[model samples]
Target: MTTEDTSIEQNDDELFEHHAFTVDKGQAPLRIDKYLMNRIENATRNKIQTAAKGGSIYVNDTPVKQNYKVKPFDQIRVLFEHPPYEYLLTPENIPLDIVYEDDELLVLNKPAGMVVHPGHGNYSGTLINALVYHFENLPNNSSERPGLVHRIDKDTSGLLVVAKTEESMTHLSKQFFDKTSEREYIAIVWGNVTEDEGTIEGHIGRHPKNRLQNTVFEGDDIDKGKAAITHYKVIERLGYVTLVSCKLETGRTHQIRVHMKHIGHTLFNDERYGGDRILKGTTFSKYKQFVENCFRVLPRQALHAKTLGFKHPKTGKQLSFDSPVPDDMQQCIEKWRHYAKHQDAK
Candidate 1:
């Protein structure tokens, strides 16, 4: 029997272009995902894994498993939907910590371990997913993400704002885009900063090769990365690490984490981009072993958006709110302080 086949010629609108391979290879069997990878080159295995979950991909003109065997007379076609991609991020019944709310906007003290939005590797249990399930109408104007103004990293806990209406979202988004909203954070870093207060200046862009991380480099064009500015001050000195307050002059992806690392003082739990080398010079080395070992108990990033202040996009009234660090962070700090004092006595 002759099998009919269809193929999609994908465009490179996204970072990488994909072309679908389909044929009437009768009576042979192969895993749907493996067959595509074998036929396609430079295609990431992870990307294939994501695409296989959807319905558009099929084997023998019928959808099958990523590991499904393709018959010899199978017709394979890839229907690549480019624009207006369907959102697979389903809403889960995750609890939200609300700090302040109004008709236009809401301020939530987003907890650690909660993903703010849906992206690769995460399809559920996200803030956006929850918002969708909760709000009857949150799609701002005509956006896929409803009521989202800004987002915090999955691990870093702090204040986040959500716009309940399109008009409000447009106004609030402008504030962040124009660098008018005031954002403040408190963090524990590995060592003492020389000046009580200072600024870290660097252009933050994606690590050209490493798709998962951001870096500080001087690039002539803005597309490489947006300008990121972090102003910080030392609040108190720990035995080895310093607890500091940070303010954002510009908001970029992972701005604080990247800037703190750039200044040689990565946040306490930010081992990914921050190294604890700040302990080299100071008396922290006295309890260096303990310093390293104690804070290590807290695995998540040691940063918090303690406070957020913004103007009402609709009411024209000033709105501000502050969030205290969760008990874990406080405990981490206290443990470090107590250990340092005990070592100093010895």
Candidate 2:
């Protein structure tokens, strides 16, 4: 048997685990689930059955039931919502801004500077830590992270939904994976976007030179990255900077920051993507000092996950939530507004 394993990262934080196998020509017929159990490490018959029930197991591109017999040379594929957790989670009694809650799921407004889940060097003070503490028996996404469905950057404040039950986790994850969920972000970026609105399309992947950053790949190198689409419209112009609303068609790590920068409008104060150094303003010392002050006020990247919408896992009702811009971003925007007004008056 030839086997191939793949793990794909989706929607910034969602991870999909994929496995493919080609049956040997001489292989005897066996139940697909049992066949997978023998080939995949640590896979249980129950887990394989669950994957089949979710229609995540395929035979020759067609979803198959657990009882289906694997014929000789048949192609088989399996998909899991997430991978195994890398860290042992410790529940912390951290405060959560619960926006809305029900028996099946809950929505919370995550503040900036908070990590979504425990990871290398950030094992504590994460949203997951807080979640496990506040709630009991929260369903683990395939990754073993309890309650988490999706995530934003550590510094991007926004609304996120957490599943309280296994059914909810499966349902909500399907919505996000199918691109039926809606997510919108508000950002303050350097430069006056020449167009009132536009769509940015490019493949996003890790930078070749900088391991910490993600960059856009175009032309012949497009295959090097994942396809990403961002639709942006100007909300307000602030002279050297602009406030914009970005709707994501596809979510990738640093999609907004990378796509905006690709168009010459790096997010204001985005230190990772080079927005912290006044990429758009004048060289005058006074102007330089003003930009520096704005940077200090915002402190992090000027991006926020402002809105989230999804279908209720059980009820099938469409639910949407919006978050107000945080105070630091508000204050920084005000400063730029004043600066823009002053420049126009001159």
Candidate 3:
């Protein structure tokens, strides 16, 4: 028998796994589940059965039951919603700022500059490493990362919800997937936003030329990207920058950053999206020096995941949590506030 295993990485919020196999002409008939068990690594019988139930197993393009007999020359394929984890999970003695913990789940405040999970070029000191060490037998998500339901960017500080049991894992994942959960972010963007409140809608996808960034597609090319929506309200208007609260309707990768940039208000100091440089303000050397000082104060993007609301997985009761803005971001905001006030008084 010959087997081919393939994994494709996507730039979006979700990842999938695909596998294919061809039965040898001389092979005898065997149960499809058993045949897959012998060929696929780390696949448990229960897992295979669950995949079969979900119609993820197929023979010659037709979904099949686990007990179906595999015939010679049959084309078998298996699809999974999430890809297998690439790196081994190791426990590390990293401290976690846990906000709330119960039998089913926990919510924590993750600091900036911390990767959520291990991936290429980042093999250690991840949130998953800390999770494995602090808790025992935490449930694995579809991607096989323990307890993770969603993630934020490495440089974006935010709140995250984690599952402790299998039931909670399945339940909480559904809430995110169905867009029933509420998430609010606070961001300081470069420019004075004219509107008090508005909604930005566009298709968000990977940038064709730049693999590291995502862009918004519109009009005739809308089909190229997935639909994303962000509702933003002006919280305060600085002289050259604006503070806004953004509510996510669809949790696409970099949704707020891309959508805001599409409208010409990129997040302040977000280096990847070109917000690190002086996008607004006068050309005077003193003004330039002041902006540079603000950049140094907030080295990363001025965005924070401030509020999260979701239904309790086990009890079906509603729960909400809020986090205070980190000190660095708060200090930077204060500086901008003072600068705007001084400019108005002059």
Clashes of each: 11, 0, 0
Q: Rank the candidates by TM-score, best first.
A: 3, 2, 1
Task: For residues 3-27, write the lDDT of model 2, one tens digit per residue.
Answer: 3235544345443445677776767
Question: Each prediction's Cα lDDT score?
Answer: 0.72, 0.86, 0.87
* Cand. 2 TM to true fold: 0.75
Which residue pairs show backbone clashes in model 3? none
Residue range 212-256, candidate 1, lDDT tens digits? 568888756456676778999998887667889999989888888
* Model 3 misplacement above 4 A: 1-86
Candidate 2 Cα outliers beyond 4 Å, as residue runs = 1-86
* Global Cα lDDT for candidate 2: 0.86
Q: Clashes in candidate 2: how many? A: 0
In order of appearance, the predictions have TM-scores of 0.73, 0.75, 0.76
- The best candidate in terms of lDDT: 3
Candidate 3 per-residue C-alpha lDDT over 1-346 given as tens digits, one digit per residue, 9 for 90 to 100: 2222354333343324456777767678889888887666446789898989987887987889999999889998776555533446889999999999999999999999998997644668999999999999998887678999999988889899999999999999999999999999999999999999999999998765444578998889789699998999999999899999999989998899999999999999999899999999999999999989998899999999999999999889999999999988999999999999999999
